[model samples]
Target: MTVLLTGCSQGHSPFIPMLGAYFPYWMLCTFIGLLGAFCLRVLLIYWGIDDKLPVPLLFYFAIMLSISLTISLLYFTY
Candidate 1:
C-alpha cells in the first residue's frame, strides 16, 4: 500500500509564487484561455459567425479547455 502511494509525491508541484502568494499553474493557464475564448467570441460576433454555431456556449468552452491544455503542455510538466 505504501509503495502504491509513493508515486503520488514523485512530481514537483506546479505552484508559482506571486506577490507573497502561491498560485497553481493551472489557474494561470485557465485565465489566459478564458481571455482567448472571450476575444475569439468578440471576433466571431464581429465577423457574423457567432450566430452560426449550433452550440456556441459549448464550442467556446471547448476552445477554452483546448487553449488551457495547450498552454500547460507547452510550458509545464506534470
Candidate 2:
C-alpha cells in the first residue's frame, strides 16, 4: 500500500522576503515576542516586582506566546 500526503495550497507564501533572503513570518514574530518579553522582564526587575509572581517562568512563557500570536495575527491576517 502507498500513501500520499498533500498539504494545503493557499497560493501565498508564508515567508517575508527581506534584502535577498526569505524569512519565516512565524520566526520574525517569535523574535519580536522574545524581545518584548525581555524588555518587560527588565522593567519588572527594575520596579522590584519580578519576585512577586507565583510562577515566573510560566508567566514569561505565556507572555511571549501571547505577544507572538498577536503579532502574527495583526501582520499576517487580511
Candidate 3:
C-alpha cells in the first residue's frame, strides 16, 4: 500500500529541452499566455472597447492566467 501511494507520482517533472538546458513547462506556458493576452488587448483596442473595461489590469491578468492554465491542463496533465 505504501509503495502504491509513493509510486503514484511520475518519475520526471514536466520539462522541455531547450538547447542544453531543461526549461520548466510552466514558463513556456506563461510566455504563450502573455502573447495571448497581448493579442486580446490589441483586439480590444481595435474594437474601441478596451477603455470601457471596469478594471483593465485585472481583466488582462485573468486573460493571461486562463490562457496559461488551459495550456498546462490540456497538454501536461499529471
CA lDDT of every candidate? 0.90, 0.86, 0.91
Q: What is the per-residue lDDT of model 1 for residues 16-52, given as tens digits with 9 covering 90 to 100?
A: 7878997988999999899999999999999999999
Worst 10 residues of 3 by lDDT: 4-13
Q: Write the per-residue lDDT of candidate 2 for residues 25-66, one digit (tens) a residue.
A: 899999999999999999999999999999999999999999
- Candidate 1: where is the Cα deviation over 4 Å? 1-11
Clash pairs, candidate 3, are none
Task: Give model 3's TM-score versus the native structure.
Answer: 0.82
Please report how far candidate 2 places residue 36 from its true position, in Å. Answer: 0.3
lDDT of 2: 0.86
- RMSD per candidate (Å) reads 2.4, 3.5, 3.1
lDDT: the better of candidates 1 and 2: 1
Candidates in order, TM-scores: namely 0.83, 0.83, 0.82
